[model samples]
Target: MSAAHVPVLLAEVVDALQPRAGETIVDGTFGAGGYSRALLAAGSSIIAFDRDPGAAQFAQGLPADRFRLLERRFSELDAVTGPGAVDGVVLDIGVSSMQLDQAERGFSFMRDGPLDMRMAADGPTAADLVNAAEPAEIARILYVYGEERESRRIARAIARRREEQPFTRTLELAEFIEKTLGGRRGAKVHPATRSFQAIRIAVNEELAELEAGLVAAESALKVGGRLCVVTFHSLEDRIVKTFLAVRAGKTPGGSRHAPPVETTAAPSFQLSFNGARTASAAELAANPRARSAKLRAAVRADAPVWRAAA
Candidate 1:
């Protein structure tokens, strides 16, 4: 299948990965097959995974001999392949541009459609959460996931409105939110942006999936194998940063009140770059969606995957 959206930080990810001939790489979030296509062209075999079943249609025309698409979440990577089997793994976190553009997906508040925002076909949709979740739970989701400031007020508004009539359409909910939040008041973005994002993330459990998927990648990569992650927002980026920092043994430990505690654990990975890389001005100008993109990469160490301290 052809790419419906351009992959952000493509060259940077490729440079970090350096996929070689005969090596196997995992495209853990194979939206539109952009990275998979590029890696395939570089002569590497790929095992690509995507939670969205709709993404499989885009898997067409790929090299069948070198490519295999798994219609499952990337969190299943370690389960699907034995430890240290793949040379590299890459995850592009958050909703894709194509998903956002498709009104039927309910990822965007710009267009009117059903309030379904599931990555995979089978799941409780955004509509289910908004209509059924408790107000406090809804507030927590908005606050924690979307970082929305007026989450409580928004949740209350939704609770009251859904009592009158359950939200079934995207624009219907978006307009109600706009009215509750004072009609955007000439804001740069739509009033329902945060609500949409929060609902979508909650529906898909995206943040949890990302955390699991990163650990899975750590387990799946062979020694010296690389991991490249492209995150669109701070929530996803923060998880990636913390995971790598702790795994690389770069995180500062011990409190000012206590002496340093030592551990025998070995570093699982080494940072490939000093910090996350952002999109180039040229690329951002060409594709506005690439503006929020950030890329971070690392090389795996020979040490076994670290488990949480008991």
Candidate 2:
């Protein structure tokens, strides 16, 4: 599999990592080995992980000594590798372009293909969720993940339609959503875009995986090790923001009525930078997916790990 993936925030990630020779870095998402390749070029050894088996085929010609690919999710990082052994950990959260571009993988609403949306391609599909989930559950998923305001209407339509016949194809569901929700003509994007995002996220438990993966990355990094994350949508971005803020002791808690107290335990990492960094204009023009991408990074503090305060 020739890598068609365009690694988002490539230059920024390399700059943030500042990999040195012989240091082991974990490319937590390792979609197309973009970050891994760059790290190798920078003289760092890499232990990359990708749950998608498809990426293994793409690893064919990669130098085995400098880079190693593991067919596993980033959430399993701690289980798969020794803790606090890596010098840096980079996670590009969310689905990859490889998955979206492959129509048979069924990630994009623009393409016509099967309804299977599993990132690993080995689990419950979007069709299963649409057909089996309660309308309220589906509505919540749409509202939270897709940020779809018309979630109720869409969920009701999906529930009603599935009674007639289960959705099997991408275009079939996309067309149904567009027809039910009424697509906006001349819009930059299709109306089914949000619904597709909602369904795929739900099917893969993407957010949950991200949360687990963040904690795993935190645990896996050595002192002063960098944890770099690039999130695409607001949902993923919010989680990354909150996780970093809490870990860096930047989350605000008190209101005017109550006096503020630092409720969190001693922070495990210090804020490497204030806020998320976005790609430059040049990168944005090249990869439209980088338009909404936000890169947030933090360095593991030398202080001992602090368990969450109860």
Candidate 3:
């Protein structure tokens, strides 16, 4: 494992999936192949997916007979694997450590690089978003995605500045955001952190992709197959939590004050355990990034995959 890209909750995720010989597992986010490599060690065949072209560099040296890497998004997993094909699916949501460490990737504000934050090789970059989006849209992106409190103020400042010069560099925007927010006021985190996160999420459509990927996992896993997800923030966690809760038949019944959520389809998944698992104290001591990480796992039920009504 790369010291810089330590897989979060590896032991817990491996325990949840319990890979066995001849079983096929899908590594939904093969950033540095940490999960895939661990699962492969357990004697399972690995089918890993990553949209980032740079991720292919890490796939080298792995046994070609046991491991296969796909240069595609995990949301397309079911389309590639077909229904109920895999034994397990594991997703590590949000940007990868490798992406952050590469200055040219433009995922970290601390790094001075071009303002391109696309996870894949192509797309409208984060620079395009901030420089061209309307002030209201930019504020909405910051407030909704980043949960930044001073989103409107920041958006206004960005609007005023972009009129004179477009943001092309990561540090240029980071420093501007810091100055606009009055030099962080002794805050532990930088003022640009939230804004950068919001912009990246917006540029990548991360939340939507997560929702679609979860549904894809449901379709891809066989009965009794495992699905494990590691989410870094509340936005991602909430989606996974709700998806499992509803799919596990844990939704609330009708009440006098509120109507019941329509239960039209059979539950397709069962929670592996109640609630999510956090990293152990030892794990947290080694990796501060694990502080915000939450691991949720479930087992596929012997039922049909749920489809939303048109």
Candidate 4:
């Protein structure tokens, strides 16, 4: 793992969790075991999960009794570790710096390598999605996940290029996007950045996993237990924000003219703070990835879990 791959929101996450001796906390991301290490230092038992097998290799030599690592995604958390049993659950959602730093992982357009961007290293790669997805479907992924404005144009370019020669390498895809979108001249951000983000998210099913994981986390947490999520992009942050708001019953009030309805399901969570928190300027200076991170936390309310609307 690269030394530069420091976990974002480390201090804030640890402080929010407030782990205590004998308490069991779940580090749902387990990227580089940064948060897990801190929790262990605080004398809390940790159950850490990472879908990436590479991360498990790095976790060797860690105290086995105090910390246990699971080779699973956070969405499968409830299935593996029974529901409503944890004291707290922390998820650092989206791609990890470890995956992005290694060019072989093919997450970064800045470095040239194979166009593979599988977090697990054994799943469908970015190349597969880009080469096979329909133009409309590709456009939708870019728009929704990457928030790319020129999604249609970019998708069209990708479709056109792949017909002549399918992209197999990172720079091949990146250079195609750059040339088609107009390379570096006065570009605030790289032209290929959003396109790469869209493909990676699609390849990993990141948004879907996040949604499922949020629901699973809510169900898995005990009443009064906390769920803390750190999101680095707007799409993920928006989902986290809305999920917490809905659970806290913070929805806009109904008009007085409307008939009052009896409550069938109790609100399951209360916001730990008024709004999301960001890292300190000092932290951002040390880790640039921390700049975009937003932390949202909520404590489970003393109520039964509410099923999704049918």
For all predictions, the C-alpha RMSD in Å is 3.0, 2.9, 2.6, 3.8
lDDT of model 1 at residue 254?
38
TM-score of each: 0.95, 0.93, 0.96, 0.93
Off by more than 4 A, model 3: 252-261, 308-310
> What is the lDDT for 185 in model 1?
71
How many angstroms is residue 291 displaced in model 1 relative to the true structure, after the best TM-score fit? Answer: 0.9
Over the stretch 1-310, how does candidate 3's per-residue lDDT look in tens digits? Answer: 6676669999999999999999999999999999988999999999999999988988888989999999898999999999999999999999987789889988899999999999988889999999999999999999989999999999999999999999999999999999999997779999899999999999999999999999999999999999999999998998888788878988755444234565767899999999999999999899988999999999999998886421
Give the best candidate by lDDT: 3
Clashing pairs in 3: none
Candidate 4 on 121-146: residue-level lDDT in tens?
Answer: 58888999999999999999998778
Model 1: how far residue 204 lies from native, Å: 0.3
Q: What is the Cα-based lDDT of residue 144 in candidate 2?
A: 83
> Candidate 2 on 109-183: residue-level lDDT in tens?
889999999988588899888999999999999988898999999999999989999999999999998899777
Q: Which pairs of residues collide in model 1? A: 1-59, 1-60
Off by over 4 Å in 1: 1-4, 252-264, 308-310
Better of 1 and 2 by lDDT: 1
Candidate 3: worst-modelled 10 consecutive residues by lDDT? 252-261
lDDT of 1 at 157: 95
